[model samples]
Target chain A: MAMKIGEGKFKENVNKNMEDTFMRGAVAGAQERLRTRRLDAAEELGNWEEWRSHGEEIRKHVLDNLDYYLHELAENLQKRGGHVFFAETADEATGYIREVVNANGGKKILKAKSMVTEEISLNQVLEQEGCKVIETDLGEYILQLDEHDPPSHIVAPALHKNKEQIRDVFSDKLDYKMTSKPEELALHARETLRQEFLTADIGITGCNFAIAESGSVGLVTNEGNAGLVSDLPKTQIAVMGMERIVPTFEEFEVLVGLLTRSAVGQKLTSYITALTGPREEGDADGPEEFHLVIVDNGRSKILGTEFQSVLQCIRCAACINVCPVYRHIGGHSYNSIYPGPIGAVLTPLLGGYDDFKDLPYASTLCAACTDACPVKIPLHELLHKHRQVIVEREGRAPISEKLAMKAFGLGAASNPMYAAGSKMAAAMMKPFTKNDRISSGPGPLKAWTEIREFPAPNKERFRDWFKQHEKGGGEQ
Target chain B: MKVTLFITCIVDMFQADVGKATVEVLERLGCDIKFPMGQVCCGQPAYNSGYVEESKDAMKKMITTFENAEIIVTPSGSCATMFKEYQRIFHNDPVWRPRAERLAVKTYELTEFIVHVLGVENIGAKLNGVATYHPSCHMTRLLGVKDAPMTLLQNVEGLRFEPLPNAHNCCGFGGTFSVKMGNISEQMVDEKVDSAEQTGADFLIGADGGCLMNIGGRIERRGKPIRVMHIAEVLNSR
Candidate 1:
């Protein structure tokens, strides 16, 4: 229920995830499907890079003047007869949302897929007040039925589970006997959820993007459940991260295009719903009382810092899809609701390094995430920045690593130390060297040797070889 | 064309044969090779781990060492990418940033140097074996040397190139990441080796020594019968 999901060392989590062949198969299959779909969509879109740049520019512009846009958004929403609350912390945000439900005499809230609500833990707060909460999104419904299982991915909440697992969850909770086919499961979930939506007093949804100029919230979904959640219930509440707003519809269009393509490789999502305030006098099926909660939590602190570029993220998960680390470990290993490259950088900042110190080092610095990112977040570099903070600022890096790095710093920066280190390298590794390869190595080499052979230090260093060749004029 | 070889520290001490092959291959392709002895390391190992202060000394050493060379070339893509990274590292220092840019402008990975700079696609090399190339992340993405290695290898006589499954994935040889997060690194390398085996290639060829060493070491330990060779070694072979 806390921010950390798979809380432990990254290696232990990875080992645990790797052992779960079922989960691995599910993750790898999803990644392959999503990766190809994303690539094909981008190729079809044509000038995907230009669109990405435009999206990045719009996000940067919005973030640069976030205060102005937030005010403009609040003003426009207030004009349209909607209540707006800015919560600076998670406690405040959840507290405000609970009060809204209490004032409305709400019980049995029907919720659409919303990451921000999960991030702020809003459902638990409402449930503690003794309200029945039902998740309407198909993936979310399965996870909610399975004793509120944590979402592994942003787009696919139950990404770690295959249809068989979903069927088991549905069979046990819903007591339905059916095949593990997706359509069968989806139909069963829809039948079960339809009744909940009809009786629910309130609906909660996360805003994909908020239009500041018109005070409209945009929701992009494949299932169209979000539209039902927002419109069916008499009382509706939308929760959004403060950075999720756009200045105008033009900027919103660019971002939605980039988001749909980058996230699941769709030119356009099946449903793109934009709702403004509440239903008017002439309106046909919609919520009457609407409230918008813009939660800052820890985002404001990152506004002007070096990490501001991270805010440009559209939650596309292209970075996550291509990440080598995420490919093997799946999302839970990251120990946060958010995982992969973005999570590695974002989690530690939001939750602090004490709980997620290892997240930064979880990457191989492969820059695969950096390349895959549509908005050009430089995710790998941001991850490195976390390491810098952990080491130089927080001083939380393992003492052994710090000591080793210190020695490396002294040895690497100076010519004499490097020369001496390179000279004595062959002898130092002699005990481990066999047939010119160190099959079993020592110290740092131990980890490498666990799976692969470590090449022994050459008898004659390249410096020596180069010097000899130079003196002898180039012949081997 | 005269090319100065920045034999990365790994190639300098651990994989000297790779450096030798690189020199031979470049020379065979009509390059006059110059070994810059003062070039000890590219400072990447420290720089990447956020030891900027520590890495600066090596960066300065390299800038001075290869300052006079007509064109700087290296056997490692990761290391060559490090040359491209120098400007960013010295962004605050006006004097060093320009010098770093100059180094980056002239630097290339061995295959890139041979194919792009020298305009030599075929070097008359013969290796009668099916090989799959692992395009290291730094080389293909960061350094943007994607097609040069493939272009050169396509012209190699008697060599059958197989496509590596999941070739775009990292080999889990993230320099210190191999040892720092050894458990994760082990799993990643295992998967990489598995993918290479699926290719049915006799050998795994790569541009960077770091990747080759990782994949090669795993192949050796598992006794997979798949030989791992650097691009230079593959290109130099006849």
Candidate 2:
């Protein structure tokens, strides 16, 4: 699957998602649950701020010394007989992965859910070569079963789908008679996936953080599917964004703690596995031949830019959970595999403004996402930067908005213009005023009136009132 | 304390009563109030919309307008936050950056000024009603003025305070957003109005005029009995 999931315009996707009451309810419920859990987890830590700061430091340090760490990680991994390919583009990344799959004569590949893999459209590449790639993560597996349904959320791929929906998908595809209880559905999925896990020709997992010092790739998951995906197959490939590297195991531990708490509000997920290279002689588990594909895909462009901090993200959806926009519109509205505030920022950088220009403006600049970010990425600020780029640099903004904003700047900056504008507001709004509120209006007011009543411009401006009140000696 | 009023554009043109209450509240606390007529909008409507270069004109106007005031105060937390933002906005400008810094340090949201600067929790205000507060996102999250609103509200005589469900969420009046993405803003504001209704409160109080207008406008359209109020107006109650 591609990074951009749903077809049509961003607004079209939003309107469609907004109309889906089932999806909206599911998203809101999950947001509340995850939000509370994250808060509780952070509260349990008693020093979440410190932990967050540490996480930010580690990620920032890694990003700053990325080249050194990448070289070191690659050297150490190759020393342990692992193949490391650094792909500066998505096409190159997918090309190398396809070569590995073809070389191994891979079919029926077992995969741990990975946003990077979704980003690079690896599954589509493999499928074109006639490979049946199975999504092992429960959320991803549910989506995969539903005829390649694009994931709505990053961590919880099927977050927009309720249990009943999942059960329906399973019943239609797997033809199983089972209750909608999560346990029952999961058990059935587990039973179905167990054989595929053991017999898959190749195992592919997403790396949470590539440990440079130990040359190990860490996988953090609640499902423990990563362990099985990397262990059961003779050939294994781990894909990671180039920026997802840590200096050593020490920084890795710190980040994993922050990631789990922020994403699921757990102290640590059910399984946190860090594997170093291929299995040695007499090793019980792990692949004999391992390949690491480090995908750049437009990340380096942000390194020295104002958005350098965005690369510090640990893929924790804490920002997504707290976002009011994401709460109302739901994840599918974002259209990218990386949804919510992060998507609004990253998608434009990777996918370009042609498709994602409106993504940045989708936010209210509430800073909830910024506050929720464990690694201290200024998500809201980055979003604002996108807007500036669209208007100032890109010149993609509508001419009407450009004119209106230009007028706003002039009226606001000059005292005479502001006074005339303020003085004329009430008079200009008179025709629309009804009982001190503009129920219907013009221009921007037309949009405002469509949703909510617009307040009639006060006949007496506050400055005029203040002048009179001061003449009355500021009497109450 | 001498206080200069930066009554935000929404208050100046639309919600004058909010500005009035803010002045009265500060005056009763024995602080001298200054109203600089040159003050206009905080450039947020433009700035937040991505017209950063255009927004600087207004930001500079604001900086110059309140340049001489000992301390600046506004009823809107979001506007106050914007005032604070000017420093960072002009961080690289050698000419305006220092001036922006001076203005930011002295600026305060009304509730913040009353509680933090005035050092008074309550001003002997009394309001008998069931009410809840909607903390505007920029106020609580950006400005970090979370406690001041509650501290004063909790001390108000005869006011029954029930927390609004999902109080941390935005009221969906993101200046331009309510207009640009009206559909999404509609959903958000409707949910906010529903949450306030869930509280069964007579009044829904907020610290920002823009948020009040959004929530209040929806409450009006839906014809809910709940009265939308500004925290300044609520605190100004006798």
Residue B176 local lDDT, model 1:
86
Compose the digit string of candidate 2's lDDT tens values, residues A1-476.
88988777989988888889988888889889999999999999888889988888898889889999999999999999999999999999999999999999998899998999999999999999999999999999989989988887788888888888989999999987989999999999999999898789999999999999978999998888999999999999999999999998888889898999899989898998887889999888889899999999999998999889999988988998899999888887887888899999999899988888889999899999999999999999999999998999989999999999999999999999999999998999999998998998778989999989888898988899898898995436
Query: Which 10 consecutive positions of candidate 1 chain A have the poorest summed lDDT?
Result: A1-10
State chain A's TM-score for model 1.
0.98
TM-score of 1: 0.98
Clashes of 2: 0
Residue A317 alpha-carbon offset, candidate 2, angstroms: 0.7
DockQ of 2: 0.89
The DockQ-based CAPRI class assigned to model 1 is medium
Give candidate 2 misplaced runs (Cα > 4 Å). A473-475
Q: Candidate 1: lDDT of B87?
A: 94
Which 10 consecutive residues of model 1 chain B have the lowest summed lDDT?
A: B46-55
For model 1, state the Cα shift of residue A407 in Å: 2.1
Candidate 1 residue runs with Cα over 4 Å from true position:
A473-475
Q: After superposition on all CA atoms, how large is the RMSD of candidate 2?
A: 1.1
